[model samples]
Structures are given as structure tokens and as C-alpha cells.
Target: MTDGNPDRPVIVLVHGAWHRPSTWDATRAALAGLGYETRIATLPSAGTDPSPTASMYDDAEAIRREVDAVDGPVVVLAHSYGGIPTAQGLTGADNVTQLIFLSAYLLDDGESMYSRHGMDAPADTSGTFPLPENPGLALYHDVPEDVATQAVADLVEQSLLSFTGTVTRAAWHDIPSTYIVSEDDRSIPTALQEVMAAHATTTRRWAGGHSAFLAAPERFAALVDEIIRSR
Candidate 1:
């Protein structure tokens, strides 16, 4: 693999459940403008399969493949449910220098997303998880109306198994990490975010909803850049 830039580590972006890689278009562009190369990991759990069977472990494998494909050092930024797989994926990955959890679920070993949310795992995990009735309000309330509408339209059904699958290994236990809290997030409660943030090496609070990157890509990218430089 060719090194996009030997000076700066590649930024590997992991999108949340129900979201596609395209959701990071604005943030990726902004990061590129800031002299950082970015790569997006496509989660198998958030695909077009009607009877989705992919679990968080499958997503972890996908993330590992992306990280292993990078030639230089890497910095992974995981959003929402992406953090669970990310924590499991980066195990033994020496090239990954830092992990950034953006309004993400920082789960421990044997902890599933459902368990993290105080919900019991469903007995059957063969189907796709439905999106909220109003994703615009739940996820992108801070974003502009047009952007929120487009985001809602682009959402796909997430795999139920992904949420039910427990974390086998947590990479955050070994790797240095930073957690950025979305203060106004509705999807994941702010208190829950704070609880998860305690596991990170550093924690930051940003004023915005769950999808802050969508609402303010430039500002989000700047904050990311700042975090990267601090390392």
C-alpha cells in the first residue's frame, strides 16, 4: 500500500449504525483540506441485506482490514455504534496510534450495545433494526433542514445482531484514546456519553447533537485536527 503521507497518520473513519460511508463526505473533505488523508471502513452490519445476519464481530473484521491496509500510522475515529467494533478490531494493531470516539459507545469486553443502553439483548437477532420515526430530530437536529432530510433519506436498516453481539475484546483497554462528547445528543443520552468518556485517556465536550460532524464539518474537522496534533 502506498503511504498517502508519511508525515501524518491516515484518519480511518468508522460510521455509525444505519449510516453509510457517504455520510462522512463533508468531514472527509474538510480533513483532506487540513492536510490529512482519510479512509472509511464500510461496516457489514449496516448494509442492504434485508435479513441481516452480520454482527459486530463482522464489523470488527472489516475495521481491522481497513486498518491493516494502511501503510503508515493510523488514527481511527469511530462514531456511535462504530466504537464497539472499533474497540474490538484494533486489537494487536500496532500502527494505530490513537482512537477517537465521537459520540460513540465505548463498550467493555462482554458488553453489547443493548446491554450498554440498559436493554436486554433480543432473543432473535436475525433481522434488521428499524430506524427511529424521525431520524432528523433524533440524530441530526443541529444540522440544517436540507442536510438532515438528506441524511434521513440515506439511512439504511442496521443489523440487530450487531447490537446484540457482545464485545469479545476491547482495544481501548490497551490503546490510548480520546472521547468527544456531544452535549446535546438525543440518540445517546449525555450522561451515558460521560460514563463512557471516563474510559478514554482524554475527554472533550462539544456543543451539538449526535451528528455534530454533519452539522459543522469544518469545525468538527478542526477539533479532530487539534486532537491529532496533541498526540
Candidate 2:
């Protein structure tokens, strides 16, 4: 691993459902150019398991392990469904300096992602949740055509158990957090983003689709830098 600038905290990125760590390539590159080290927490719920049994708790454990590996201060940036596991994972992590929820779900204790959407938790949390018919339209609408197409093609099925699992603890409740709302997001409605943003320490609105970072990576990285520096 590259021993990055010691003065800056490592940025740990958690991608949303149906996305792999590669989805963060642009954003991570931009952050690297800005002199910050970065790491990715690959959630098991979104892996290539034919019959995925991993729950949000499993994803949370993955995130916890990632953060634990970092030796210094860390900032976790979670997108969409990634926030659910991110919250549960960092519950008692003292090295986590801040959390940035990027158009992400912010659920409270005992709340599952399904419950946040006004849907009852599934009694049987087996199988996987398939991606939408046109995931590119919903998630990367503002991104370039080729890039969006590739992203859509790379999408995977998310585990149903991940959504049905309730959060036992929320790290944001004890950690300083910033919520970035994508005003034009179609995947997660703007109104819902606003509601979730209420749980954050501060909120910022961006005029783009759900994966705005893919559309404008440098700008997104700059915003992340500003947020970190503000601390």
C-alpha cells in the first residue's frame, strides 16, 4: 500500500447496491490527485454469490474491517444503500472522524432499509434483488452515455437479506456527519434524501442524478475535500 500523505485522513468509500468498488474509480482517482489516500469496503451482499446469504450485518463487518485496517483518522463516504451498512459498521470506531452520506440511506436503530421505504421487512430474506430494467437511467442519467452504459452492465444483484436486516446501532448518531443530496436523483427520491439528511450534522444539495460523482468526479472530490477540511 502506498504510504500516502500522513496529514490527511484516508477516505473509505462504500458503493451503493448493484455497484462494485470499480464504480468508485473516477472519484477515487480524483481524491488521489487531491493528495488523499482512499480505500474501498466491498460489501458481501453485492458479490457474485449465486445464492447470496450475506446480510447488512455482513456488509457492516466488511466495513468495520476496512476502517480497522486504516492506522489513522478516517472519513467514510457511503452512497445509496451503502449507508445502511456503513452506519451499522462504524458504531464504536474511534478512528472514524466523519461520515459523508452521498444521496444515501440513513436509517435509525431497529430500522431496516425496507422499513425506511414504508415496506415491511421480508419474512424470508433469501435470494437476491434484481437491478431495475434501466439502471443507467435511474442511477447515472447525467453521466456520459458510454460510461453510464458500462456502469449499468457492471451492476449485480443485491442480497435481499441486506435490505431486510435492521440496524442495531447507527454510527452517525455518535459521529459528525454530512449528507449530500442529489436533487435530481431518480433512484432515491429527492424528498426521501431530504428526510434522511435530517439525521446528519449538515446537508448539501447537488444538482445531478444519484451517481453524480461519476458525472463530475473532480468536482465531487473537491466537495469531499472541502467537507474534510472544514472539520
Candidate 3:
């Protein structure tokens, strides 16, 4: 689309905690098939970086680098914990025209994953916490068996700082945004996602679990394509 030039806005995908860019393979492929240019922000708080101090702000800055580097319009599509960084990173980015939060957090200024989830304590007290041996039931119960197994095997440890870090600016406050709520999510309860979805300009729902992108890449890509074309 647009001859693969920077004229058309690109879809920058931000993945959730414990996940990396590889998690978006299927969705990215589908988007490419639809002629959408897509990019994935390297999450500092995720991957096998072995860095014990990556915070949410660091992740935000990583995304900001990608956002600021791009030309033309941008649709920052964030999933799960990714919503936090995208919300922070997109602040003051003139090129970003839209935001799409997929089963993700949309916190207010001074809010955090810990506070929003009502978890009195942070999961990464020791800097980073290893992902559970089995996240199938919590995050991938409804996902296809093979996909869920691969995703679980690929999960990385996430920084605890990201869990407790609070947002200084909520970009969604000034940006047009759509939130996709995962109705069957077990990691982030559907009820809570609905509450967060209220902060979005509009909302959509999917009868899937937390790992909706991996479980239903075609559907996710179709929705993203619609958003991009609407602009």
C-alpha cells in the first residue's frame, strides 16, 4: 500500500509482558497480506536481554524511538501490557494518528499495572520474575493447543519495575483510540477490561482469551486493517 513508502501510516505492534516481537508473527503476516506495513517495537522490559532494570518508562522510550523515526501517520497497536508503553510513548508524537489497544491496559496518569489490577504487591520484587512454568490456563486456555504451547515455550521473564512503574502521561487522553476487549481473558479479567475499555473513544469485543492475536490472527488483522483504512 502506498508503494511501501512512508506516506501511508504504518502499524507498529507493541507486545505484552513476557512476550516478544515473535509473538506477532501470524498477525504481522496477515497484515502484510492486506498490504499494510507493520513494525514491532523491541520491548526493553521483555525478551532475553538479561537486563534486570528495564522499567515501563524504558519500554515507552523504546516505542517512542520507533514512533519518532517513522514518517506520515501512524497507528500504534498495543496488546496487553503493551498498552502501557504505547500510551506513554505516543505522547507528543505528531505523526501518530490513532491508537489500537488489544486486550490491554489503558491506565490514568499515576496509575500502574499493580494498582489497576488491585495487586498490593509487585510480581517482580526481585527485579524480574520468571514466567510461570505453565501460562496455558491463565492466558491461553481458549487458544489453539499448538499455538498456546509454542507461545508458552517462548515466553521470557519480565521486569518487576514495569509492573510497579506508573504512567506520567496518558496519551489516550488526547489521542483518538479504540480498545479491543478480550471477553474470555483469564489473565486480565473481562470485567476489568470492560472498565478500562470505557476510557477508549470506542470499544470492540472478541470471544477469545488473553492471547487473542495468536489464537485469531486473521480476525485481529482484519480489525486492524479496517482501522487503518478508516483513517
State each model's CA lDDT, in order.
0.91, 0.91, 0.84
Alpha-carbon RMSD of each model = 1.7, 1.1, 2.3
Models sorted by TM-score, best on top? 2, 1, 3
Clashing pairs in 3: none
Compare candidates 2 and 3 on TM-score and give the better one. 2
Tens-digit per-residue lDDT, 1-231, candidate 3: 223444557888899999989999998888777777887898888857665568888999999988887777788999999999888878888888899998899998988888897777654365686665568888889889998999888888898878777888999998899998988888888888999999999888888888877888898889887866675
- In model 2, pairs of residues that clash are none
TM-scores, one per candidate: 0.96, 0.97, 0.92
Tens digits of per-residue lDDT, candidate 2, 1-231, equal 245578999999999887889999999888988899999999988977575678899999999999999999999999999999999989899999999999999999989888898898767778998787778788898999999888988888888888888898899999999999999998999999999899999998899989977999999999999999998
How many Å off is the CA of 74 in candidate 1?
0.0
**Alpha carbon lDDT at 193, candidate 2:** 92
Q: Judged by lDDT against the true structure, how good is candidate 2?
A: 0.91
- Model 2, residue 135: distance off in Å is 0.6
